[model samples]
Target: MRIVWFRQDLRCQDHPALSEAAQKGEVLPLYILNDTHPGKWVMGEASRLWLHHSLKALSDSFNGHLAFYKGDPLNILPQLIKETGAEGVYWNRCYEPWAITRDKKLKEHLKKEGLDVQSFNGSLLWEPWETTKGDGTPYKVFTPFYKTSCLKGEPPRTPLPKPTLTCAPLPPSSLTLNAIDLLPKKPWGKEVFSGWEPGEAGAEKRWEIFLKEGLKGYKVGRDLPAQAHVSRLSPHLHFGEISPHQLWADVSKIEEGHDTNHFLSELGWREFSHNLLYHFPSLPEKNLQEKFDRFQWKKDPKLLKAWQTGHTGYPFVDAGMRELYATGYMHNRMRMVVGSFLVKNLLLHWHEGEAWFWDCLFDADLANNSASWQWIGGCGADAAPYFRIFNPITQGEKFDPQGDYTRKYVPELAKLSDKYLFRPWEAPEEILEQAGIVLGKDYPLPIVDLKASREEALAAFERIKEK
Candidate 1:
């Protein structure tokens, strides 16, 4: 018998471990829940909620035969082995530092017990170690790394087909889905997030939707938050509800063009993040460029709270934060805008923004979240130039030209014209009164002066560069 262990790779299709297990023998489908396993990398409220729904969907796929156990995998896997008399265990790999450490130790212990243990690349398009510079070192910048990876390849191997399974009966200690309690005691997620369907089927639905609606205009429209031109697939990809290989294959069906290549490069960024994390386990905590350590960052609780609650009074920044609060997701362009606002305009550390997003984002991926925040804060490898500060007012006016995205999330500013919509503080009192708005009462005054803050941020950044 074979035990098919599920971790972040939750779905069944094109899953190397599950597919291989089915081909070999009777499969004991398993998901072990140990919040202690990943240490401080434990699931946040949003991820916890998604996991609950995902497990239910996975169990339903197994026809209610999946074993859901709550314990350390060391203790639980042994018990499961004894229960089923399984000769081998198989699973897809996880790339997080904690997951890497845990998987290695677990694999060693299991193999010592004389049971066959196997793991496969069920998550990434290429193994993180596979892509490297010609000198056999990791690439620190993105463009050369992206171009080099493209040139080095036989394109991604075709995704494996779903394998037929011979199921084993569940063990007596198997826990019910409710016992996991990935859902919150509070009702915030269920109430706010009804738009997503969390399962393999749901992943397929989103894949189809993106292809039909988003493929043609993604190059131009992806940056426009008001348009439905981007795929909301990050959470599913994070949960392993969908595979990059599958997404790649489908997009490849499109006639090769700028739009298709742009979308593929975004996927490459996901790959690049894992590449960064694998090589530098300190990714979530330490800045990649050590010079950033000297960068002056403030610890004003008011600024942090203002940014988190979406009341910074910058329309685009606030809209992104509010959207994250109201619906657990933010548009990518807005993510960069808000990230720059917190780190640059507010002079708060990038870690503060990173931590907030870690808690609030439904698709809060460790590698992408940390790497992207550092990139925007101008402290990471392949980071933006320090001089290229994002002007949030102008960003809002440009991308969300008609104020549609702003009005949706920041409805208090709905009556303001596009001219003053993004920078409401600059509006005259007559216009404010006409629009039935009051600064700091109905909405908020800009928490920091844009021009003043920009100059301060630039000077502070220069000091760090000199150091």
Candidate 2:
């Protein structure tokens, strides 16, 4: 019997490991909720909720043959091996640093124990080390990295039809979902559960909708927070509930025409991020550019709290933060705006903001999250130059011209006209009074002087550059 240890690659369809394991022998499907790295920020609550739903969905599809385990895999798998007398183990790869270390040790130990072990590239369209410059070094900048990846075309095809028979008798599993403790005791999951449906089927449906309807308008409307033109598939993608190769294949079916290149490039950006993470394992914590270490960053708890709670008083910033709090996902444009507000307006460490996003975002991926935060803070590979500080009000006016999304999330400014919604502080005293808007009380006053803050942040960047 073979053990198919499911990690990030959660689904069976288009899963190379699942296909290979099934072909070799009877397979025992397993998902271990190992929390050994709990203090290392194991995974966010929103992601755990999504995983629960996705696992439930997979269980349903496999007729409850899927088994759940908890604690360290190296310890648990050996015990299972003895119990089932399984001959070998198979799994897809995870690129996170901890996962990489864990897999290395596990594979070596299993090999010594005389068990067959194998892994496949299931998450990304290309492995991180696969594409490099002439010197065989990974591409540091996204544009060139994207160009090279595009030239490589899609990943080699490895489609697996759904299994026709049950994989072993589930090994008389001693494990249960409650043992994993993935669910919270409180009601925090209520909102997340109601909003997001997690599972392979849900992910497939989302992909189909995106390719058929959203991809065409993605370039133009992806920036509009009010519209659902974006895929909103990040959580699924992040958790390995879906694969980039599968998504690339499906999207490729659309001929190379209007917006097709735009959509594919965005997916390519995701691929590049994974590639970055694979090459630089410290991506979640280290600044890609070492010079950024000299830059002075604020450690203001009050400002961070205000930013976290969405009371920053800057309407655009507040709206974006509140949108993230209310929903685990934020629009891509709003993500940029909110990140700029945190790093530039508050002058806090980009790492600080990155840590917070790591806690809150359902799609808090190591590559995209870390790379994007550094990009906004002007300390990443191929980053926006340090001088480009986003004007919150102007950003709101440009991306959210209608203020419809702001009205929905930041209801304190609801009664105010869209014209002043982005900059409510500019409204006359009488107008503010009529809207029940006590600027400092109901909503926050702008936390920092936008122009002054921008200059200060720029000066700080200059200091780092000089160093």
The best candidate in terms of TM-score: 1
Clashing pairs for model 2 are: none
Tell me the lDDT of model 2 at 339. Answer: 87
Query: Compared with the true structure, what per-residue lDDT tens digits does model 2 show for residues 338-412?
Result: 888888878898888888788778888878898788888888878888788788899889988888888888998
What TM-scores do the predictions have? 0.98, 0.96
Clashes of 1: 0
Per-residue CA lDDT of candidate 1, range 1-467, in tens? Answer: 89999998889889999988898889999998888764466778888888888889999999998999887898889888988899999999999998898889999999999999999998899888888887778888988878887546658879888788988998888889998777887877866667898888998999899898887899999999999888999999999999999999988888999999999999999999989999988989899989888888999999899999999988899999999988888999999999889988999999898888887888989999988988998888899976688999899988999999999999999999888999888899999999999999999888999889989999998998887
Q: What lDDT does the true structure give each of the candidates?
A: 0.89, 0.82
Question: Stretches of candidate 2 above 4 Å error?
Answer: 153-158
Model 2 RMSD in angstroms: 1.6
Clashes of 2: 0
Candidate topping lDDT:
1
Q: What's the CA error at residue 303 for candidate 1, in Å?
A: 0.8
The weakest ten consecutive residues by lDDT in model 1 span: 145-154
Poorly placed runs, candidate 1 (over 4 Å): none
